[model samples]
Target: MAHFPVNHPARPLYRVLSGLIGLYILVFGVYGVAETWGDGLFSREDTSALGLRTNLAFSLVSVIFGAFLIIGASRRGNLGHYMNLTAGAVFLVTGILMMSVLQTQVNILNFSMATVIVSLLFGLILLATGLYDKVGTEEHAEEERRRREHPIAEAHR
Candidate 1:
């Protein structure tokens, strides 16, 4: 089983970072929507917003995802942890998939290299935050610390 830190000391910092990323995505989506309003939903035009290429469809999706991240970051329980993990995986997979079709007609999102980079970066950050932001009682934390410190002993049990 995967072991995530419980009661991490830097949980607040991670939360703040994820929140900032969410805010940026939200703002970018709004701007992208305005910039591509008259275009086709999946237009292949070279519309740009916040240094990332986008289309109406992509902008709408971004709005939804950004809101999700914001809500997840605000949660004070394991809900946030699970949400962050899910979001991170989505972002990473999306980035890779988009990058694969960067110059092909399959690029429905009209993703540019910069957009792919940002997606991957956000994914990594969110994944890190999720891994260390688990909430648990002191006893759970102590057990985790002990397990981490004595992996050999733990494996034999």
Candidate 2:
């Protein structure tokens, strides 16, 4: 729960991307739930976002996960980055698995080609963002320390 400065060089990118991803996912889940709110959780016939059969219970889980991402993103700390990375990995793996097992398995969590591709791409974005913009990493800490210890001399132009 360390507080990173919002003005940190990479903070804006981190916040924007995290927030966007979270918002999209949250909306996606909400849509799915609304689509099947009265169908008793998992419908045997309701297809939803990414071709998955929408289930109230599963949709709630998605919404919670999305909220987690959004909450983490609101922070200036590294928590959001970590969450993005983990969530992305999950989405990527699950999407691929779903695609592979599409025909053989009767799953409420389903997939199409678009779903697989989107998940893979989103996962990559999350991983890249997390890897690139961490605040307390050794390199960033070192750079900060240097800035504090050795202020740049003003030009006397």
lDDT per prediction? 0.93, 0.68
In candidate 1, how many Å is residue 99 off?
Answer: 0.7
lDDT of 1 by residue, 1-157 (tens): 9878899889999989888889899999999999999999999999999899999999999999899999999999999899889999999999999999999999999999999999999999999988988999999989888888999999999
Q: Which residue segments of model 2 deviate by more than 4 Å?
A: 1-8, 44-46, 49-53, 137-157
Per-prediction TM-score to the true structure, in the order listed: 0.92, 0.72
> Among all windows of ten consecutive residues in candidate 2, which has the lowest summed lDDT?
148-157
In candidate 1 the C-alpha lDDT for residue 94 amounts to 96
| Residue range with the least summed lDDT across 10 consecutive positions in model 1 | 2-11
- Per-structure clash totals for the candidates: 0, 0
On lDDT, the candidate that comes out on top is 1
